[model samples]
Target chain A: MAVPSFLARERIVAKPGFNRWLIPPAALAVHLSIGQAYATSVYKVALVEHFNASLTEIGIIFSLAIVMLGVSAALFGTWVDKNGPRAAMATAAVFWSAGFIVGSLGIFTNQLWLVYLGYGVLGGIGLGIGYISPVSTLIKWFPDRPGLATGMAIMGFGGGAMVASPLSRQLMNWYDDDYTGAAGEVASGNSVGFLFLTLGLVYLVFMLFGAFIVRVPAADWRPHGFDPATVKQKSLVTTENVSANNAIKTPQFWLLWTVLFCNVTAGIGILEQAAPMIQDFFREGGTSAVAAAAAAGFVGLLSLFNMAGRFVWSSTSDYIGRKPIYMVYLGVGIVLYIGLATIGSSAVWLFVALAAVIISFYGGGFATVPAYLRDLFGTYQVGAIHGRLLTAWAAAGIAGPLIINGILDMQGEPGNLVASDYRPALFIMVGILAVGFVANLLIKPVAEKYFEPKPTDVPEAASTTGDRSLTR
Target chain B: MSTARTDDRGPQEGSKGLVAFAWTLVGIPLVYGLYNTVKAASALFTG
Candidate 1:
């Protein structure tokens, strides 16, 4: 497929002395837009009422979107690499915005399957492509600080919901006078349709702005005062390239896969049941001391921690190195889970502080992995490799909810359970984190056989840019 | 001496106005989002 001339990789190459700072905002535009995926919970009740569907039925919409996010990213990882960020970002914008438009049509017409097809399948593709679009480019541009570069961009993803959650509520309120923006008050279907239509147009403009402004670093462009030799000197940091195809064949990739799966699964154990879990933990004499509003506030606080950890910890990885950081995320994560299960209910502050740090480690694991891959595989195809690795997140997405929700279901119903009811699930997470800890410890540098036969680019000026050339 | 090569099109400088404009554009919404989240999260302590 030929890329439109305006969206071609060559068209957006950075000129000499181009500002690298411009690239982070460009990445933020797409991520912030797609990050709306997390805010679906805000309108979940409204959709259930409007569509007259079961909670499970409506929940599938989010599940399907996440599953597609992983699938499309793996499938299109190379295409994104082949096309430059401009082309990939533009395509993601179109698919994402169109998803909203189509979803609006479904809501307006009262067709459940249309909403699924539009939001779940199409919007999900947009999510995946947009997620990886800026990754390798950022790493290439800021080679001196790969963790910081990628961290700034990925943080936008965690922050997107902060904007969308409130924005969607206001938009829904504006579209419907009868709909009070209060807990349990559902918005009308028409209001949701209009909201989708409005978001679609709004995101399309922002994402296109990102696409037009984003630039690939000029061939032979290296940041001043940075040495590739300094990078090579770090243990497990490779200057040699590895094709994404060969990346999968290595044991290190799968070990990292297990590490991500365990981290995400344990985190989701808390996130999936954050509000209710807090209430249940503190329940006394069949009633909870924690107010509903306070529980909601706990969820909000966790989101803040999650977003901050992505930037703070990932940037910390630049100084500490990637492997050591995972030890912090997974190793410290074990002790936190134990604290939560054993004595979380003794005090609210203790419980909140422990859960906040655990969630931050979860978010840190995500932001740090791209830099981790760049460490092991080099920049040749880090984006595609990153895309492949996200399938673990998709797997954990299913496994996390299932494990927690399944255990909770077996114990008893909500509103009647106490802290001990959750001990089993929290302990299971401890086991999961232990497995990830071992996996992180076992990760060694890729063996020599997996290296591309010839190095793709040297620190010298002889090497040129354009992703296609790098892969070849 | 660092073996790294530099692109000699000129010193790697960028326009201050453009950089400021770009950051402000994205920064405003992010700040707005952060403010709202912090306000909501405060309920955990106060409530």
Candidate 2:
């Protein structure tokens, strides 16, 4: 099959003076579209009723997609780096939109496996590729500040959920003709299918703009004020490149992976159960409970913090250095979890503020890790490395929910459980945060032994059609 | 493998006109997204 003309690697190479700032939005376009995966819960009840399936059954779709996200990203990281983002983004767009379209068909036919095959398997491949598509390009373009560039794109992924949750609700409402129906009545399959169709097309259009607009930096390109010599001032921030395979062999890579895994696990605990956790925490004298609406508001606020932290803290890493930035995420994160476990529920305002900060660290951890990789590993295949690192996210997503839910489930139902009921879980999170802090401290400069010796000649494979690499 | 390629965007890399067009084109969706979120978050208070 022929690649689309617009997505041709040679054609999309950035010309001299090409504005690199345009690259972030291109990244955002793809991230935002794929990030819609987070908003799948917006249709949860609707699907459960339509398919007449158990909640757990519907949840398998999400689980499969997430598992596939990690597997595919790790498997395809090298391919994406070799092919360049234009091909990756374009391929991701096709798979993502097609997933929705095919999932729409599954809904129409009332076949659950089709939904799994469509949205779970196919859409997940898109998610994996789309997630890492922009990192290399952005890092290459903004050599002076890899963190800031990646932060912008990663932040957009969180914001995509904010946008999609509301947008999806409205679309579902528009499609549902019988809004005021009987309790047992299921939605017409056509209504749900239509929503999927609309979403698929809309996302495809946005992603196409991203694919067409994205461009590769010229091999010799550098920003006006940038100097290669000055950047070497940070001893740990290497100019040396490491291929993704060699990167896995380094102790630094595993340490960073542990740091990301622990940080994400701690954050996800608060995030996964934000609404229920709040209600449980703020139960007043067994008669008054935090309003469900207000608890949801707290969730929305945390989403804002999550989105803001990505841009704010990650960009800050450029000035403070990546290691120091992680110190804040892991160290401060421990303190906040401890406070939350001990007495966060005593005051509503305190609870909100603490959760907001914790969530920001969560988003910060994600945004900063890619830049962190660039610091330790260099920009040669940073995107592939970042892709490999995202497996940590898939791991944390499960671990976080299990730790929180398991503990809470042991203490009876959420609303009846007092603040003390959550103390054990929150304290566990503190220990998790502590482990991450030490991992961050252990992250010294990657050993020189693992570094692939720089070669002057182009390798046989790299010299082929897709010759758009940093070494050029 | 050579930096001998002649593909540069020239001095006016992101010309004002192109910049404006690109920014505005993407800005619409983003701004709408922000607006939509504020509305939803407001529900927790107003409710």
Candidate 3:
């Protein structure tokens, strides 16, 4: 399919005078907008009430969106690479905004399935495409600091909820005069409907700004005082390119996939039940010492840590190298999981601090992976490879919640659970992190067989005919 | 949309301002979000 001329890859190539610094902000604009997906809990109650549906039914919307995020990213990864970031970002903007509009109609009409179809499926595709759009471009532009470049944008995803949560509350209150945006106050269905509409339109503008401002660095571009040859000196870093199809055939790719899956699974164990888990740890008699308000605050604190880790740890990876960073995230993470399970209830501060660090590592794992992929696979089809790798995230998303919730379900009812109740789940996460640790250790460089042949070796007929298959 | 070679001169004086403006546009909202999160998170210790 032909992209619009305006959105064509060649159309948006950067001029020499273009500031590389501008790219991060364009990436941020799209990420921060789509990151609103994380803030769904804010309106979850309203949706449940409006549709008069089960929590499980309402929850499936988020699950489906996530599943679709993985699916669309995997399916569309190459298309995005071939088309360039401008086209991908614009496509994401349209689908994402349309999701809100369609979902708003569902809310207004009290149809649960439409909300699922719109936000879960359509908006999910937007999320997938938007997520990977800027990643490879950032890596290419900042070859000198690929970790920091990718980190800045992924951190925006972590921060998006911070912006969306408050914004959504304020918007919902404005739309429904009867709603005061209080702790238990559920906005009217109409208010949520309007909120969706407003957000859809607003996010459309921001994403388009991102799309318009975005530019691919010219093929020959390199930062002053940088040497491409120096990049190959790092262990596991490669100068050769690997196509996305061939990438999956390499052991290194699956090892990294397992590494991501374990890290995400462990992190989600804490996040999925953050509020209740904290409360349960301090439970004395049937009543917890921790107040409901304090637990809410703990959840907020974790979000801050999660956001901060994406930038801080991934940037740190630039200095220490990507492999060492994963060792820290998974290895130290195991010890922290043990501490949380064993002694977490000993003090409130101990529990909060441990959980905070674990969540940060989880966030770091996400932000660091693109740079890691760039190291092993080269920049040739990194966006596509990154897109395929996100299937681990989708898998971990389901597995993590199930592990935590499943264990907790057996221990006792949520409100009545005690510190011992969480031990089983916490220990399981330790085991999961152990798996990731080994996977990270086992990751060697991609074998030379997987590397794409250099252009010089191409048959003249194939080259002249513009036929990729002959080269393959 | 202008065509220029990669070997050309670095960013001109004009684009410097555009870069700053772009950063500020994205920065304000992120800061706002961070501020709100901090305010809410304070209750973890205070409460």
Candidate 4:
């Protein structure tokens, strides 16, 4: 028997093909730039030494950038959905490039506010826009492989730090001759200014490549043999589409937000103080500065697991479902944090291994959440919902560093951070993750009452007139 | 079903080269970036 007209329409809309290929590069372009957040640690030592800034002061820069990423994303997400990837990516390029330039000026003038303006305010907008540009489009193109599609893009965000960390380190070395300058001493500002300028120009070019290559799939496109019924079989995976505005009102959105917030906060607690945390933990056991630097390098190593887990774990979600995977992330994550609090410092490898697993889940949480949204809300406005959801990230950005550094500051000793000293923070993270775990369990499928389908007139017009069937 | 036949014929036309080129462009960067990341991370951790 022939399929019904409605089924045929659905098939065409869900079809996948060569166009799906375009989404990844489009995503990579933006992710690569925002991924620099991961490598911010590489700059921490340099900034502290160059500006004679305290750790708390330097951390404020990262906090501001992250908070901005969330806020700008929420603000721009709906606009991004309406306009298309081209406009969004182009705007991201402008703000991101401008951020670096502004930051360069700040560095040259010895103005701390400019640095915050350039890197935090300007760069944060770029991070938010770039992050969501390809997300919904890719999910639409690869409906059958939502996890993998989102994973491919998010993996770029995770891996971006791996490239940036080494590249930034190399650039610093290239620009400045004195790597061995005294701890916390200011370096010549000219070199730093020039480096920021060069980075800005290069990123502008790459972001444009992403903007240009991104194209919505032809109308009436559907995957070669897709069966929507199969998707219905996966309880955690939903085929229904929800607009971003409606998604915010649902219990599912808040639950997922809490899950992401807890996961991010837990990871950032260790991440923000990675170098010092490792040094202090091992110092009592007689590990030296060289060993500590190597351990810092191990922290960089976690970015790989972070990157890999984004792709591997989230892609695995396509088959396993989103909720169960998050269960593993939170469940295993709690155990890992508990181990770190209790037994991490006893052996260096134990610390490294447990830290790597926790970091992987941290990265996976980001990669998987978009698909989770796709499952709950449909594709209609998933991008905007994803964008709004980032506010949780912004909150965590502030809360994470504050919880970690605040505790450390209260202790009143610069070099005396030990495993015992970290107990309160670690326990806080454990409780936060547990709360998120409960939220994950509480998440129910978004009800139909919450979903307002896209205007039939608009979708019908596009399907009949536009070349891309998939986007329709 | 008629539309399916048309879709099949279009893929048979000029799409082969475009598909190959796009896949290569996207795949190469992805593979290289993943390889480079894993290698770098390994060196940092193991060394």
RMSD of each: 2.6, 3.0, 3.0, 6.2
Interface Cα RMSD, each model:
4.6, 4.0, 5.5, 5.1
What is the CAPRI rating of model 4's predicted complex? Answer: acceptable
lDDT computed for candidate 1: 0.89
The local lDDT score (0 to 100) that residue A315 gets in candidate 1 is 98
DockQ for each of the predicted structures, in order?
A: 0.45, 0.40, 0.46, 0.25
Tell me how far candidate 3 lies from the true structure as C-alpha RMSD in angstroms: 3.0
The true-versus-predicted C-alpha distance at residue A89 of model 3, in Å, is: 0.2
For residues A1-472, write the lDDT of model 4, one tens digit per residue. Answer: 2323422222233223344565677678778767877677656766776677898787787778877888889998887776667677878888989999999998888887898999889998998988998898788777789999999999988767766755665677678788433334333556677767888997898888777667655444556666667898988566666767788989999999999999999988877787678777776644433254465567657767778889999999998899999999998899999999999888878888888889889889999999999998887778899999999988887799889889878765857666788878888899999999999999988887876643343454354222123322
Q: Higher-TM-score candidate among 1 and 4?
A: 1
Deviating ranges (above 4 Å) for candidate 2: A1-6, A180-188, A457-472, B1-14, B43-47
Clashing pairs in 2: A15-B8, A15-B9, A16-B8, A16-B9
TM-score for each candidate, following the candidate numbering: 0.96, 0.93, 0.96, 0.85
Score candidate 3 by TM-score against the native.
Answer: 0.96
Q: Which regions of candidate 4 deviate over 4 angstroms?
A: A1-19, A44-59, A177-187, A285-290, A409-412, A453-472, B1-47
lDDT of model 4 at residue A418? Answer: 69
**CAPRI classification of candidate 1:** acceptable
- What local lDDT score does residue A343 receive in model 1, on the 0 to 100 scale? 85
How do the residues A1-472 of candidate 1 rate in per-residue lDDT, one tens digit apiece?
6798888777777777788888899999888899999999988888899999999999988888899999988888877877779999999999999889999999999998998999998999999999999999999888999999888888999889998999999999999998878887889989999999999999999899889889988656788767789988889999887889999999999999999999999998899999999899899998888988889999999999999999999999999999999999999999999999998999999999999999999999999999999999988789899999999999999999999999989999878989999999999999999999999999999998888766344432233332332343
Candidate 1 residues lying further than 4 Å off, grouped into runs, are A455-472, B1-4, B8-14
TM-score of chain A of 4: 0.88
